[model samples]
Target: MPVPVPRQRDIPATDSGPAPQASLTLLVVEDDPAGGLTVPEILDADGHRIRIRSARNLTEATRLLTPDVHCVLLDLDLPGPGPGEDGLGALREVLRIAPRHAVLVLTGEADADRAAEAVRVGAQDFLYRDELDGRLLSRAIRYAVERKRADIAQYKLAESKLRAQENARLERGLLPTPLLEGSDLRFAARYRPGRSRALLGGDFYDTVRTPDGTVHAMIGDVCGHGPDEAALGVELRIAWRALTLAGLCGDDLLATLQEVLEVERPCEEIFATLCTVDISPDGRRAGLCLAGHPAPLISRPGGPARLLPYDDSGPALGLLPRARWPRRQVDLGGSWSLMLYTDGLIEGRIGEGRERLGQDGMVEMINRHLERGLSGEALLEASVTEARRLNGGELTDDVAVVLLSRAAGRTPAA
Candidate 1:
C-alpha cells in the first residue's frame, strides 16, 4: 500500500526563494515489519513540503509508479535475493519500470559497498540510512532531478545533430550538379529554402551541355513548401536531364515531364512551374519554353536586362492534359547572360509593403547589379542577397537561381 508523508508548512523557506514551487511527488519503496516506514518531513528548494508515497514492496511500487511521480527512492535493505543472486535486483527492477524518473537508493552504513554499486547501476544517488536527515535528503533529491534533466537534454542534442548530418548528406544527393564540362558557358547558381532549419525546398535548377553542342538550363518551383515538394522537384529535374541527354527538346520534352509530374504528384491540385532554355552551339540563338512560369532575364554587355517573351507560355505542368508549351526562338546575340529562377526570388515583399519584387522589379535590380560590373557567380550572389534584404528578412519561400553566361571574347566557336 502507498502512504503519504505529512505536510510541513511551518518549515523556514530555503534560500532557493519564495517562488511557488511545483510540488514533486516522490515514491519511496521499503519493507519494514512496523507496517509503514517513517520519513522526516522534507521541503523542496522553494519551501514547499515534498509529497511522498510509500510502497512496502516492488509490487506496490510498480502499481503506484505513474507519470505524475517525479522520483523514486528505494531501500536496498528489502529481502528477496538468495545466496547467488545479485544484491541490486530490486533496484534494477525499479529502474526498468521507471526509466524516465530520477532515482535514489537507501542502504545501511555497513552496506556501503551495495550503496555505491546501486549508484553505479542506475540510481541517481545513494544514502546510508544512518545519515538520513531532512536537509541532506532535500538537497539530494534536488540534485538527482537536475542531473536527470541534464542527461535527457544532452541525449536530445546529440540526436538532433545526427539528424542534421544525415539530412545534409541526403540533400547533397538530391540537388543536381551542373554538367557543363566542355561547354563555353559559365554556370553559377544559388538556392535557399523558406522553411526554418531546412536546407532544401521545392525549388530546383540544372544546366547541362549535350553532345550536340546545345546547352540546356532549367529552373522550376513545385507549388508548395516542404519535403514533398522538394522531392518532386528533384524527380522532375532528373527526368528532364535524362530526356535531354536522349535528344528530346521543346514541347516533346515538356509533355513527357508533365506526364511524370501528374503521375508522381501527391494529388491532382499539385502542379509545377518551369522555365527551360536551350542555347545554340554558336551562342547566338536559343529556344525558350515557359510552362506557366516567369520568363528568364537576359542581359548583354552593352544592353539593359530584359525578360524573354512569355506570350506563348503554356499552363503549368499537371494543370491540364495535352497542354502544349510552344518553344519560342530568341536571339541571344554573341555575348550575353541568361538568368533562370524560381518565383521565390521575386515573390518577396519589397520595402515591407504588400508590393512584391515582381519580374519588373527583379529586372531593374539585376540591371543595377550588372551596371556595377557584377557577372557570373558574383552577379547571382548579389542579386539573391539583395532580394532577401529588400524583403526586410529571409523570404518565406524556396529560392533557386541559375546563371549561364557567354563572355564577349569567349565564344563557344572560339
Candidate 2:
C-alpha cells in the first residue's frame, strides 16, 4: 500500500491575490547505491513541494551544495575522507562547508548516542532513519534555517557594540587638557563636531603656562573632516605644546610646526590653518601669529569688540614651502577679554539663504552679548547657542572656541 503524504495548512492569499511561495532545496549525503534508504515526498508549511538531491559521498555532496541548497542531511554511517574511521567526521566536514546553512544528521536507533554527539559538533538537529518521514523532515528544516539566521544577527550586533565602545575610549584619550596651573587668566572653551556620534573632529586647541609666566594658547583646523585629518590635528597640537615648553615661540615655533605638518600630513594637498597667542606675564600685551586663519577678537572694558591684526598673516601650513608667519605685537590693555575661534563659527549660514555670517557680523554679535553682561563660560555658552540658532540648525562643521579674561585690580581665581 502506498503511504499517503500529509498536507500542511494552506497559506492564505493577500490583497494582491495568491502570493507565490518560494521552494526549499535539501541535500542528502549518504552511501545508498542499492536504494536502501528512501525519502518520502515532503511539502513545506506553505504547501509547496520541497526539492531533494542525493550524493554518494562528501566529495559529490560539495559539488551539489549550491547557494540554493538551504539545508543539509547527513548519514552517520558514511565514511569520512581521512584515514580515521570516526563515525561523525563526515558530519564535521559538512558543517565546515556549510557554516551558514542548516545541517541535520541521520543515524539508526541503536546509534542514537553518536547522533546526539553530532548535534554538539554543530549540527542543527538529528534524526533516526527508521522514524524519518516527510512531515517531520520538513518541519525540522524550517526550524534549522530560522535558527541559523538568528545566530548571524546576534553576532553582528555584538560586533557593532564593541566597535563603538573602543572608539569612545580612543577619542576621549586624544582630547586636550589645559596646563594653566598658577595662572591668573580665566579659561573656558567649547568644542562640537559636525559628524554624528563623533567625540573628536579636525579642530584642536590647547593652553599652557610656561615657567617664565608667559601663557601660550593655540587653536587649529586641519583641511579635511576625517579620522586621518583628526589624527594629524592631534599630532600638530602635541608638537606645539612640546616646542612651546621647550622655549620656542613666534616664527621659530611655527616654522618647526610647518616642518612637522609636511612630514606627517597624508598628502601634499592637505593643509592646516592655525592661530597662536603668547600673553606676557603682566597680561597687558600679547604676541599674535596667524597661518591663513581668522584673527582673535579682543573686547576691552566699556568698548566694542574688534579683531586683532591679521593683515601680516602667512600662508597655511603645507601650502607654501619655507613660508614665514610673522608674529605681530598687540596691546590688550588692563582688564579685557580675548576670544579665539576657528572658521566653523563664522562659516555657518545666517538663515535659509546662502549668505554666511562673516567676520564683521561676528564682531557685532559679540558686542551685543557683551552689552548683556555675559562673560566667562556663560558668554561662550550664549555665543555658541546663538550661532546655532541663527544658522537655523546645527552647524555643518567643527567648532572650537577659547576665551581668556582678566579684571582690573582683581586677584585671579584660585
Candidate 3:
C-alpha cells in the first residue's frame, strides 16, 4: 500500500494528491547488522515512515513474514545450498508461505550478475547496498510489486496462445483424409468446436485406404470434455490410422487402441464412443462397427433415411481392455449415402425442458434436408448449423460429421 512515485518527468503540476497511507511492511533480511542492512533512514517518496522489520537469517525471515508484510528485501551474501539455492532458496520459501508478497534483493556493488539471476528466479529486482536512497528505494518497492503482477498476467496470456497453436496443429493431424483416387464419389466433412477450444474435445473422425481398394472411415466422441480428453481422442485417431496402414482392423485394431488408452490416459473413469465404416470395393455393402457410439444414418433414393442397426455393439474404447467391437455388414442399394457423426450433433436440446434431439430426431432432420434438395457439403453445413441453432448459440460440445456416398449405376463392372 505504499504510494506510487511518478515516472522521471511525469511529476504532477497540481501538487500530487495526498500520499497513500503507509500500510506496507517490509522485511529486511541480513546475516549481520555490522556488515549491511544498515540504511540510516528509510522513508516513503513523500517522507512518510516505512515500517522496517529486520531478519538475521532465513529462519528469522520465515518468522518475520506476516499478513501486513508487502515486500521482503534479502541479502545476497547469505550462504548457499548451490547455484539454485543461495538467495533464491530463501525467496522461494518466503513466497511458498506468502505467495503474494513482493521480493527485492540487496547485493554487493560488483554482484550485478547474481542480482539479475535472483530476479530471474522470481525476485522483483535488486538494489546495490551503497546506492539506496529513501525516495529511489520507495519507488523501487512500489514498481516491483506492480511488475510482478503484470509478469504473471503476461505469462498466462502467452501460455493460452501456445495452447491454441498446439490444438490447431493437433486438429489437422487427427482428422482423416479421402484416399479414393479416381472415384466419382465426393467426400464432404465438417467439424465445429465446442465452448472450450482447447482442442477437438467432443468430436473426432479419421479416414484411410488400405492396400485393397477399400476405404475405412470413422467418427467418434469422448464423453465429458476438456483439452486433455481431446488430446486423448487425437491420439486414438492417429493410432487407428497407423494400425489400419499396418493391417490391423476390426477387433484387433480396437483392442490395441484400448491398451493405449489404459497406458496413456491421465486417469480412469474416462471412456470414448466410436462409429466406423468399411465400404466394399463394389460400393454395394458397408461393414459397420459401433463401440458404444451412436449409429450412422443411411440415405438412399426413394427410401426413408434411418439409423443403421447397432445391436450387440461393443462397449466404448478405454472402458475395458478386452472389450469386443461387433462388426455388422449392411447391403446398400445401387445409389446410397452413409453419414457417421459424433453425439454432439444430437444431444443439442431443441426447445429446453431437457428435450434432446435424439437419434430419431436427427433422422427426421436429415429427411427434411432431403426434401429441400440439399446434398453433399451443403447438406452437412445446414445440418450442423441447425443443430447449433437448436442449442441456442454454440452447442457447447465438439461436433464432427463424415459422409461417404456411393453413386448409383456403376454399369455392373465387366
Candidate 4:
C-alpha cells in the first residue's frame, strides 16, 4: 500500500471536533513511474501516525519542503541534478535544499559504496530499499533528526566562543597604557564597563608625561552606552594624547578636542563631560580644567580630602560653538594624592531606593578607605568595591578612575 498522506490544504473551521495534535512530517523524493517503490505504515516514537509527502523530482521536492517537515528521504537511483554520474546526484540536491532538516538516503544492496559516500557528503544515514520496514524506518528517522539538531547546536557554540576571543583582543588594544617614563608620580587606574561581557565602554582616560616634565591626565565619558559611543570616546582619547605630546595644553588642547568630537561623534546631540589636569615639573602646582565634568578630589597628609574648584567649569564638548574652558591653578602640598573619576562612580543607586551615592557619599567612602591605609591600586579597588556593595549590585554605567600621587623627597628618575 502507498504511504498515507496528510491534508496539505487549509480546512474550514467547524465546531464538530477539536483540532488534531500536530504529527511529525516526512518528505519522500523518488521517481517510480511503475509505482513499485512503497512506504509501509510508519509510526513515530510517540505512536502517532507519521504523515508522508511524495515528490517525483527535485522541483516537486523543493515545492513540498516546509518548515514543519522534520525529515527527508531521497532515492539515490532517482537521477538528474548534481555533478556525479552515480545515482548520488539526487541525494546531493535534497541535502542542499533541506540543510536544516534531517536526511536519509535509500539505495539497493549492490550500491553500498555510494551509500557510504552519501553519508560523508552530509546525509544523516543510509538504508537498503530491500530492508525498508515500518519499525526500522521509524528508528532511523528519529535518530537522524536528533543528530542534525546536535550538529547545529555545536556550530552555534563554536561561533560564539570565537567571537568572544576576537572581542577580547580588540578591547585590550584600545585600552590606554600610561606614558609616565620620566615622571615620579605613582599612577593607578580602575575601569569597568556597564555592558555585559564587555571590557571597554564610552568612558576613556589617559596619562602622559610631556617633554616639558609636565604630566597631562584626562578622564571623560561619552553621552551613551553603545559601540558608537565607545568608538567616539577612543577617538577623543587618542586626539588628547597626540595634542598633549605636541605641546597643546590648557584651553587650546580642549578646544581642539572639541573640534574632533564635533567631527567624530555619530550625532550632533551627543556630548562628553571631561576633566583635564596638567601638573608642573616640580609636582607642587597644577592647572585644572573641567568641561561639565565632576571636580577631582585631593587628599593631603595633614588635612581632609575635598573637591577641586569647579565653579569656573565650562559647558561640555559638542554643546556650544565657541565655548571657552578656563584653566584654574591649584597648589599641591609636599605629599598628596589626586583622584579623577567619571560620574558612573557616584551615580549608582543606594539600596532599593531612588537615591544615588553622589559626590558627598563618595568623599565619605574614600575617607574611610584612607583611614584603613589603602593607597594606590588597593585604594581604588576598595572604593569601587564599596560603591558596588552600596548599590546592591553592579553599576549600570561605565566607571573609570585615575589616581596620581606625589610623595615627599621623591624626584623624577634620570
Candidate 5:
C-alpha cells in the first residue's frame, strides 16, 4: 500500500530573510526500552527538525502530554492492567488523556486485527513495527495533525449553525403579532437592543383587542440588557395576554403580573417597569396604569403632543409585594394617537452634555415628526433614529415603542 503524503507546509517564507520552517513535537509511548525503537533524526519537508519525546509507560506518557505535544505514537502491545483486564487499556488511557491531540498506534506486523481495532478506538492510523521508517513516520504525523484540525473545524461549524437556528426560533416566539384584526385602530411598534447583533433584550410590548371591543396596549422594560432579562420580558408579556383574554383588567391584572415577576425573576433585586392602557370601546377614553414607568404620550389631530398623568404611578414590579398600581381614567379625544414607550427612548443624551432627552424633550421631538406629516411606522422610525443621532451613537439600552391610533367616526358604537 502507498503511504500518505504530507500536505503543504504552514511555515511562512520571506524574500529579505531566511524562510521559517514548520516544526512539531511528537510524544511516543512504548514498553520495549531495549528494542531501541531508534530511527535516524528526521526533518519535515520544510527542513525543520521533528522533536521526539519517549515515555516508557502510561504514567510517564501523561507527564509528557503538554500543550505543545501535537501527536502521540502509542504501542498497542504495551502492558496494561494485570490479568483479565483490557489488554488495550494503555491505548484507552492515552486516548482519554490526550483527546485533542492526534494519535497513531504501533503494533507487530502479525497483529493486523488488533491494529485495525485500535484504529476504530480513536487512533488516526496504525503502523506495523517491521515497516516503520523515519520518512513514513514523519509523513504520518503531519497527515494526522491536518486530519485532526479538519475534524475540529467541522465540529465548530455544525455547532454554530445549530445555535443560530435555535436563536431564530426564540426570536419569533418573543416578538408579538397584534390582535387587532376587527378593530379600526392602527398599530405600529419598534424595538432595538443595545447589544451589537443581538436579536432581543429586556424591552417588550403587545396590543390586543378584548372581546368587549376595547383595545389593550402595553410596553415594558426589565432592568437589565441580557438574554435572561429578555426571556423574563417574554414571559411577562405572555402572562399579560393570557390574563387580559381571561377578562382580568386594571389593578387586578397588574397585581397578578407583579406576582409573576416576583416569582420568575432570577434575584430579589431584579425589577421591571411597565405601562398599560386600555382604550374605551368608543375610542374616546382610556384607563392608564403605570408601575414605575413613564406615562404614554397622546396627541390629537390638531393638538400638540403631551404626556398623560404619571403622578399616581406605583413602584415597579418586584420592588414591594404590597405595592399597588391604581388605574386612572384619561380622556383620549377622538382622532388621537397614543405612543407608549420604554425608558430607552428618553434616556439617550441630547448632545455631548450629560443631560438626557427627558419626557419634555421627547414630546418636542414627536411634535416635530408629526408636523412633517409622518405617522405610523414612518413616525416611529424617525423618532428612534433621531434619538440615536442626538445621542451621538446607538443607545446602550433596549428601546421598545408602541403606537395606537383611532380615527373619529371609524369605530362601531360601543
Candidate 6:
C-alpha cells in the first residue's frame, strides 16, 4: 500500500517566527562532476535546517526515493547514458514512481518557458538556477505543494457544478409542462441519480400532447450509470418529445429511437428500455407500450393496485436492428391512478438472499401502501422508502417515476 502524504497547511511567508519542523523530507537531483552542488548551504527563513537527500543523476535519484521524501528538485540539464532516462524524461520517471511527490525543476533562466511547460505537465514548480536563494526556494516549495492541492480541490468543485447545471438543463427539456392544454389530468414525476456525485443518470422522462388532447408520457432507462449514458438519455428524451410532437407514436417512434441509439451510443451493449402511455382525451382509456420495460401499475380508488397487462412488447433499443413494440389499450375507471417507472425500482436485492424484489414484489408493496390510504406524493414516498428498506441499502441503479392520474368529471384534488 502507498503511504498517504499529509497535506501541509499554508502559513504566511515572513521573517519573524521559529521554522516549522521539517516533518517532510525532499530529494534534490543535480549533476555534480566535482561530487556535490557548488551552491551554498540552504536553510529555512526561521533558521530550521532543511535536510536534503542529494542524487547526481537519475540512477542515484531512483535509490533515494523513499516514502518520507515529499519533494524533488530536478536539474533540467544532465547527460543521458541510460536508454530513455534523459533529464526531463528522468523527472517524469520519478513522477511515475512517486506520484504524490512534489517535483520542482531547476532550469536555466533562459529556459523559463520550459519550466512553465513542466508545471503544466505536472511539476509543482520551477526554480531558475541563476536567481536561486535559500529563503525563496523554501517558500516556493511550500507554496507549490499547497497550490497543487488547492487546484485539485477546485477542479472537483467545478466538475460538480457543471453536473448540476447539466442536470438542470436536462430537467427543463425532459419533463416540460404537462402539455395538456384543456385536460384536467395531473402529471407529476421525480428522478434520483444513483451516481455518487452526479445529479442525473441514464433515466429520463417526458410528456407532450397533440392538437386532439392525446397526452403521451414516457419513462425510460439507458443501461449503465455514467455521464455518457446520462447524456445519451437526454438526447433520446429530447428526440422522443420532438418526434411525439411531430405525430410519431407506437412502432414508428420506437423505430426512430433505436436508430438514434445506434448512432448516438458510445458503444454496443448500451441498451435502453422504455414504457410509454397515451391517454385518450376523455381520460377513460390508455395506450401502453413496453420496450423491455416494466408495465405500468394501476390503482383505482378503494381497490388494490395491479399491473396493466403487457403483451409481447419488443426488446430494448440498441439490441436489435428491427424490434416491434405493440401497443396495448387498458381501461381506466374514473379517479384511477397509473405509475410508469424504470427497472431500477424493482431490481434491488431484497434481504441478504439472492432474491430480487421483482415487478410482482414491487406491485404488492405498492398495493399494501394503498390500503393505508397513501396516494400521489405520499404513495410514491412510502413505496420507495420501503423498497429501500427491504433492499437494506440505497438502490445502486437510477430510479425515475412518472404518475398520471385521470379523474375526469371529478379532479383528483377532490
lDDT at 147, model 6: 71
131 Cα displacement, candidate 1 (Å):
6.5
* Cα-based TM-score, every candidate: 0.81, 0.77, 0.75, 0.81, 0.84, 0.74
List CA RMSD, all candidates: 4.7, 5.0, 5.9, 5.7, 4.7, 7.8
Candidate 3 per-residue lDDT over residues 106-184, each given as its tens digit: 8777988888888887888888876766677777877776786787788889998998788778778756566667454
lDDT of 6 by residue, 93-187 (tens): 76777676778887778988878887877898888776766667777767766776686788889998987897788666645566666667777
Worst 10 residues of 5 by lDDT: 1-10
Error of 2 at 78 (Å): 8.4
Q: How do the residues 2-112 of candidate 4 rate in per-residue lDDT, one tens digit apiece? A: 232222333233421332364578888887765534454466666556667888878888999998899998888788585545457777778888889999888889989
- Model 6: how far residue 30 lies from native, Å: 4.2
Query: Model 2 clash tally?
Result: 0
Clashing pairs in 2: none
Among all candidates shown, the one with the greatest TM-score: 5
Rank all candidate structures by their TM-score, best first, as comma-separated numbers.
5, 1, 4, 2, 3, 6
RMSD of 5: 4.7
The top-ranked prediction according to lDDT is 4
Q: Candidate 1 — which residues are off by over 4 angstroms?
A: 1-10, 13-17, 22-25, 29-38, 43-70, 74-100, 105-136, 411-414
lDDT of 1: 0.85
Return whichever of 2 and 3 wins on lDDT.
2
Score residue 158 of candidate 3 by CA lDDT: 100
TM-score of 4: 0.81
* Residues 191-220 of candidate 1: C-alpha lDDT, one tens digit per residue: 888899998888878888899889999888
Poorly placed runs, candidate 6 (over 4 Å): 1-22, 29-32, 38-51, 55-68, 74-144, 163-178, 410-414
